[model samples]
Target: MGLRAVSFFAIAVVSILMFHLPYREVKTAATESLNQRQMLLAKQASFGIESFFKEQRNLLRHFAHSPAFLELSKVGKDVIQEEINDHREFVKAVTIYDKKGIIKYSYPNPEKVIGKDISSQAHVKKILREHKANVSDVFNAIQGFQAVALSEPMFEDGEFVGVVAFLIDFKHIAKTYIESIQVGDDGYAWVISRDGTELYCPVPGHTGANISETSAQFPSALAMAEEMQKGHSGTTTYQYNKIRSKITETITKHAAYYPVNVFDNLWSIAVATPESEIYSEYQSFYKKMIFATVVLFAVLIFFGYTIIKDFNLQKLNKELEKRVAFEMDKRQQQEKVMLQQARFYSMGETLNTIAHQWRQPLNIIGLCVQDIEDTYRHNEITEKYIAETVDKTMKSLELLSRTIDNFSTFYTPNEQLTELNLYSFTKQIVSLLQEQFESLNINLKFDEDGTLQIRKSVFFDAKVYPDVLKQIILSCLQNSREAVQKRLRSGEISKGEIRLGILRADAEFSIVIIDNGGGIKEEVLDKVFDQYFTTKSVSIGMGLGLYISRNILEEYMNGTLSIKNYKDGAMVTIKFKDSKES
Candidate 1:
């Protein structure tokens, strides 16, 4: 009992865990979905920031081909000043430089920048080296304001004349790009350079500072910077104290970063949201899911206990039923054997009485016929008639005496297995009932399927119980008799027929009895030999005849008896092994 209780407890724990498995999966999937959604939003914010910087660079490319910047010597100073005035909100100053990176033109005070060489700037160096448009990262520049320079090459008739450059203010870019976007409750966006410098930050004083190495000595910041340098995009989690929780302690934050590539320069944009804000909604639901799983597990364990007990009781009941049914079957078979033996004994006594009563009278009749023949000797025709009459009388008496002896053998024990004369044995068996069949207008015959060399004297050694063979034939013919009688009453057949055929194969003898009677039902054909299985009236059948006959043939004879439907009736076949000649 102790072990059983332990097992039950273990199963209960497993069942509860199984019931909770789906919710655990659901929680995991929900977290993944949140992560993907945050990543998607961060990507969009990054794309927006890159688009803003790209727009300024595109404006510089367009201005480079404005005819004034391309041919600055011919164009008036007012055209350049008017263009700078138009972009004054985001642009700090505009300048045009010659191929040598010297400032040949300027907007907002050209005299201060024209003679001085400003070609040492990275954006100018890129434009001179590549002869293409370029944008620089955030830096302190000619405008005395932190900015990114957008420069494009200007050409006159496919010959590079100079470059048009626009210096856009960093404060303006961040205000438009990063400050407007939002993530989760504690989420914000920022822009950084490949060197891990915070070029744009939501915090007021954090710009231009590097956070690549954490204070806790973790390398998360350095790893992110490396990813940015490689131009890769993905999600990361790091210990971040900048976005503080309610306790004002350090906590983890999930961040998604994407590279911004506009005008052949790289920057990284990132969105960070606190972990607490990500899963706050599912916390209560998780508790309820656990409670439901526990309740379901308890109910299943209770049902298992009750069902196991009930199953044991039912199994015991079935065993008891089997024992009772077995006893009843044994008793029924014993009663059937007893009844059969008693009937045989009664039949033998009746045959003996008939022989005693009829033998003297039959002999006396033969003697009287002899006297009449002697009286008619003088007339030849009369003598011939008397002789024939006497001969037939003697033959008839002898046949009757032999039939009586044959009937007496029905109960006689011939248990020693011996050879049987197929022809003579079958003739005697049929002769016992031949007169009865004839009185009922039934015809009996024998046909052969295979050739017998000495056809008149076919014989078989008994591998079967000979008396039992007689019983099987007797039972079958009796059954056939009843079937034919039923059909006659129903007008189904005008005359009844029973055929006994003998066949010889390689090493077997087959005795086939075919009768014109009601064929057996297909449904019960296999079960007809089972004890107490029958389809006749209870008064007329004990249902043991075929069952006993089958046992006798199978057990004592080492032979087989089978029945099949043939024509309008059933054909019973008995096959004995070893049909060796005697």
Candidate 2:
């Protein structure tokens, strides 16, 4: 009797616990899903706000560069008025400031602000001196209303003319974007300046307030502001008020914030949604789970009186499952490490390419130095000549710096797939290799059927690994160079010319590289892509070029690579699945 009673009680307790496990899991999943959604919503809202400001700035830039605006005096007053009026819904006014900070022109010509010297403003000085566009800090402007400003500098023939400054009404941005967000009951969205000043919040008390105070005057607001200041997007929780049944309840809510970049200015969007709303269904789940536990306990007590053993066997089975899972995880980690190692090994090729690219610029700098001495000896070293030489040297150094950056990008692994315009990609790779090939008197032309225009070709855009694509093209160019030299030595051809062709039709794009060197022998062509197979002298080339390229295209990019003979020359074609079709 004692054993039976103990078994029944144990069964009832276990069943009750089992009945509530699912409810706990469901609650956790719901919380995570809602938090993610909240963050996503915050990001989208931030993008929208940024896009709005970007468009506005672009519009001002266009206006500043237009011929009519450039010759402001030649254009009619109505033209300026019409322009400002068109954007008046969001634009408070437009003012033009010359290099001296003097207001050259103003739309609406407000009596007090029209001739006001704004050169004293920090942002105005920044635009004038730097010759760059900028967004100003929020301020109390005309009619004592809060507003922000954007300025785009104007230049004609590379000489500074003035700046086009546009004032934006803070209320417009809030009403159009911030106030429109629909969070749960008592939830809202707001915008804050980079300094944490509340620029646009639906709550009247919070608007125009600064939360950057170090003192814990308002701890919740301070925490929220600090999170937004961290940049990009993130989520944070703090104590907040949730009013219900005519009573104020202090509860915690999740807040997500995303930063917006306008010109050089940084602003942020914050969305607050009640944590209770995220798990409101949990209350019902809790009730149903309790009822289930009661029923399960009663059933187990009546029918599950006998204790079940074999816990040792069950534990052994669990141990086996854990061991299998651990092995799988370990293997996955090893595979990842191996892939990274392969990428690291490719750095040797990247370094060599960088060396080839830097040679020209370094030679230019050396030439400039030699010229300076030669000119001084000849008594022809004028200041103008020195300045010109220095300018050329600086330009060469800039090119070298950019080449270093390109090399860094060339081997970066795990890049996202992107749409590549066949013409642009071909042009960039050809340009990079053209200098090296030209040193050997080889002509490398990237064209399509002799009819494709630069930057305007519609034929070859596909999705693939850009770094791998660049590496493959570079390899082909190097091979083409060697092929030309081989034919020249054997008295097969006098002039060396390699043509890279871009071809596209119906769901695919192909890159074809053809060299006018003697075609490969039938026997050699079959094994040319094999690892460590080389025809060039030891000092000139390594044989991994075509082999690695084929592996990359086939295994990683879902593409095929093939080489064939074409009119007494070799032609290598790489075909890719077109992204547009996909």
Candidate 3:
């Protein structure tokens, strides 16, 4: 009887603790979840606004340096009109101001404000003083709308000549990013400048009012505004009075605010909701928790015996998971080893190519030495002759040194992305293998197509892992050399030809290599890129070249490697998407 009484006492204590403990925890968790949600919304809104400002600033800066703008004549006015027409969604008007801040031209009603002076404006003064780009705070514009100005100083021959500016529609930006944000039924977003002037607000009268004056009635809001003005991001609770349907009421609100940094200005975005809305469902949640507590106690008592059984099963599962993880790690290590071995094999091939490159230079140096000796023995070695021979020998030695340096650069490991002109980069790779191809009587050529020729004026720059790209190109060329050599030995052709061409598209470009060694057999073509699948003798290759090259292109460079039968031979193309593609 005593043991039964003790068991009942323990159950009551556990039930009481679980019931009360969870209520506080659940309430705290609900508040934190709301805070986090609001903060995320604010951050997203700020990011969108900042991006818009940055893009506009860059556009203005680009326009400021254009040949038309530098002309500072009627041509500059025409250019401003073109910009406004092209970007009508965000650009309301464009104005060009002389170095003294007197408006020289304004689009879409230039006569109204053309002769006006704006040197008193903060952003205009900043441009004249600093000769730098500036993004202004929201202000009333002469076009009778709220807008922000992005201005850049224009320079001619290193001297500041004038300023080019764009007036962007602030309301349009807010509607797209901030006004569309809805945290809950009553939650809305607003933006304010660093000076506390409201840029966008759902509240009708609060849109353009400074928060310091409008928030006087709400002390908590004043305090929160102070924090926001300092560029601090956080969550807070405040109280403000609002009128709905002719009834005035004071309501508590929760808010999260974040800062948005544009060129030289700061803006704050706030997402706020009524406190009643945040806790509207809490009462129902508490009622459910009460029922859950009773059910949970009964479940605990019934499942006490099964807990030990499940614990052992969990232990077994954990052990199996560990074993699987270990095996995966081991397999990854083995792949690394295989990759390294493939690199070493490629290095050996590069070394052989280097030897081919050095042979001519070495021969030239040897002939120079022999000429010097013969000249000296013949008593005809004048100062001029000795100097010429020494100069010739030095040139050959320099050539040999340059060959080693190029090879060293190719083998060096560089994992960082580098911007390179594809035309020049490919030319470098072709130069490396040209000698090796010539030694085998294979003609390797690099050419540019019509698209590439057109693109040359604006140079095709690609971000790539240069060393890895060089290695892959060399491997592809080596394969072509071997194929052509086979044809040469069989007397199928007097000269073997391989062409590497640059092909450009609207949003991407390709490096295409074509060889006339007879295409791969249709049956084995599909398996060419598979690991360890080689048509060459085992002594010559381990069949990892194409496989590894494809993997690197896909995984490291975000590119594609493809092969197809073309004409009498095979065409291999390495393609990368243009980074500038939007």
Runs with alpha carbons beyond 4 Å of true place in candidate 2? 1-13, 74-76, 212-221, 244-246, 294-415, 418-461, 464-582
Instruction: Please provide, for model 3 over 352-394, each residue's C-alpha lDDT reduced to its tens digit, 9 standing for 90 to 100.
Output: 6888898999999999988888987999988998888889899
Alpha-carbon deviation at 179 in model 2, angstroms:
1.9
Residue range 191-223, candidate 2, lDDT tens digits: 787888878776547678775642155587676
Count of backbone clashes, every candidate in sequence: 1, 0, 0
TM-score of 2: 0.51
In candidate 3, residue 183 scores what lDDT?
Answer: 70
Q: Candidate 1 on 252-332: residue-level lDDT in tens?
A: 777787888775777888777777777676566567556655654555455446546676666654564455345435534
* TM-score of every model versus the real structure: 0.47, 0.51, 0.49
Best by lDDT: 3
Task: Give each prediction's root-mean-square deviation over alpha carbons.
Answer: 40.0, 24.6, 22.3
Candidates' lDDT values, in order? 0.68, 0.72, 0.78
* Model 1, total clashes: 1
Query: Could you tell me the lDDT of residue 346 within candidate 2?
Result: 39
Q: For candidate 1, what is the TM-score?
A: 0.47
Candidate with best TM-score: 2
Better of 1 and 3 by TM-score: 3
